[model samples]
Target: QCTVQLGGSDQWGNITAGTDLVRRVAGGKAFGVVSPLLTNASGTKFGKTEVGNVWLDPELTSPFAFYQFWMNTDDRDVIGFLKCFSLLSQHEIGELEEATRVEPEKRIAQKVLADEVTDRVHGETGLAAARKATQALFGGDISGLNASEISEVFGDVPSSELEKSRLGGDGLQLVELLAESGVASSKGDARRAIEGGGIYLNGERIQDVSQALSIEDAIEGRYLLLRKGKRAYHLVAVCE
Candidate 1:
């Protein structure tokens, strides 16, 4: 029985037309139910960016990036997003709303929203990787990441390749390497940023421009992570 139909609110007319056609053909009643299209608090639609739609294809958007996209939801829009996306019951959603109102800093709502959507799209293992990558990015801990996980974490980040031999003896100078790795525009820029105390190597601050990045600095012994600031990251790989 085609007793119920669902679609975006904009498709209400089309939904009703289909229901009517179904009734006439099958001699049975049907109902159409439409929901509002998902939108951010600014009224901008979801699933879109400057480039294109946020696709469900894993190849199009990695699970880690997908989870991050939801995790960055604005506070005002999170509760509504939870209701629309999460499979949680109404009581659970209501509790989350209260928690949001009480302690927004916890980001409990955003976390739940990200977890639910990521799991639905990519599964539990994908969710775990995303969470681990998130922690590694913000918390500056890469010791636990394998080579593939490190690559996944820095997939969208700026990256470069250098001779593995360069990291052998005295290692590469911090300022010159930063510039070459595209973390800074020029050697002078790198030096200034380092002197200003903003350069980070594998999540650790590099206050001295003379600091050498040795082979030991590579995460998993093949990659060096450079950060110009808290968010801008560059990955440098050592090649034979």
Candidate 2:
């Protein structure tokens, strides 16, 4: 008889216990393979985005988000992740490493990592859907998507809905809008943030406090992505 067990790093002690039990009771030696503990560059345990755990199931973590997560992996971790997840041979992996070292902007390792894992968990169809969603998101093209797809892509983004009437002829001031959306705590703070080069609108840096949201700038006629610094992000939805 054989058994398979899957667990995190902390479960090592328990795993050994189970192996010992199997050997003593069944009169057969047991073997095991332990996966490396995933961690961030800071050595903290790896987890999902600030939201929760990274799940292999598409229902739990959408394919697009999963692809983006892998795509954004640090240069330092891409090789290790590729080795752990891809079906590539050792020589192929070595070649990938060489390519990465020689030309990181090519991001060959990261692309392979994203493609293999995405295909495995979400299948080819899902991978294609994810790639399309990613392109629409970063490429500033949103005309082809339906509402549901739009929701799926921006689900985790911090968003605030606004009434269409409120966005009348005079568009809201940038500083006031930032504060109202909780992107910044106060107008003074918002001004400072913009001046400090910490604010972005739709992926482009917005250094002017006088700027206002235009109907043409909305993604899918509803959403706007606002970024603060390198990592903090917010989404704004305009509702009719």
Candidate 3:
């Protein structure tokens, strides 16, 4: 029998039922505490929508994605979020808020919030994995990630499947692939972009317009990551 039940204001009915039952059944005193629902700078209550909900289950939302979600919090909302979701002291949060005000580009507050909240929900090992994935993706050096890690990193990006045989013999031309996979507007655009040194295969810049994707280019011989410019991405899955 808990001495107190704490939940969001929306859970008042549910929590009071438990507290009342404890008093009635065991003649014991129990307390129910309901706090207001946390929200961002916008009035949208957190965790109420499906478009950007972060789930506790790693399958629904990988630890890395969860960490990145917090990392990307808006500057206007980071401090309030830290106060509600993190265990940092008021002094530390004050420092972060000051940092945010003075050097918002550094994203100090968002980083701290992401780190503490991710570590709390996912623990140290999961936090480590999240950090590794974050580094691999943002650093543009994903060669260290295995197939599953690659999938997790680009799971939301547009993708298409290719026959495993496409990589046989001479392998597939990079320009043809860019068109087939819809990474570029057309093969000509893909070629011109390659010439401009903008296309990246598995994270490394590909300057050669003649480059071809071989089995060696595939991570674990299962997937290939193609990047256009800084943020747009597409995944090519090799299948039988």
Candidate 4:
């Protein structure tokens, strides 16, 4: 009894075929609404990132990653995504567009897009977990997160294991640790990264390249998080 069928742009021919059949056999007039293919401003198809396609399945993509996906939407694409993916009203979207123009650094539009899409896909409990994990990841406040949450947030990053003894008592030297952990290519590279203020240990910027890391720095007494820049993360797990 529907008068119109909706489909993606690529499915237009098939939709028209169905409508033709419906008119001939069912003796009814039907219309179609073909949504534009979702793409970035560069016209590259959406949903693909360096990691892979952004999946709705939480098992395929953790709630934290899912939320981060939307949060990372490019400034050029946020407005279109808000229109396409968010349930916000036109008035709300217009307001966000204005906010984006006024305060691009605040990222109000991206946050709304992330919140709406993640809430729709993962529900309130999942959204809460994602937001909390995000805050901990970005704010150097892992005290609120546990072992499982830590693992979840660090899921897509490179990870390696190290001997607990190497971190014994006084702990391992930062540059050597970074090189061995593969966060940097070599001792020289690690030192350069640290001196450039591009190194982070468990989300905290490592201003003192001379500092060492011990078991006390591990989250839940087993893991160390390393970041070379804003987005590149590496996990170091301590083993007995």
| RMSD, every candidate, angstroms | 4.2, 6.1, 2.8, 4.7
Candidate with the greatest lDDT versus the true structure:
3
Candidates 3 and 4 compared: the better one by lDDT is 3
Ranking by lDDT: 3, 4, 1, 2
Off by over 4 Å in 2: 1-10, 19-53, 155-158, 164-234
Question: What is the C-alpha lDDT profile of model 4 across 88-169, one tens digit per residue?
Answer: 9999999999999999999999999999999999999989999999987777666678878888877767999888898778
- Residue pairs in candidate 4 whose N, alpha carbon or C atoms collide under 3 angstroms: none
Best candidate according to TM-score: 3
10 residues in a row with least lDDT, candidate 4: 44-53
Clashing pairs in 3: none
Tens digit of per-residue lDDT, candidate 2, span 51-158? 444688878888888898898888888888888889999999999899989999988898899999999999999899888888767664545656567778767778
Model 3 misplacement above 4 A: 1-5, 13-31, 47-51
The clash tally of candidate 2 reads 0
lDDT tens readout by residue for model 1, 119-217: 999999989988999999888787678877788888778888989899889888988888877888899999999999888887788888778878888
Q: Between 2 and 4, whose lDDT is larger?
A: 4
Candidate 1 has which clashing residue pairs, if any? Answer: none
Using all chains and alpha carbons, the TM-scores for the candidates as numbered come to 0.70, 0.62, 0.85, 0.69
Which residue runs does candidate 1 get wrong by more than 4 Å? 1-6, 12-34, 46-53, 168-170, 182-199, 205-211, 214-216, 220-222
On the 0 to 100 scale, the lDDT of residue 189 in model 4 is 94
Alpha carbon lDDT of residue 165, candidate 2?
64
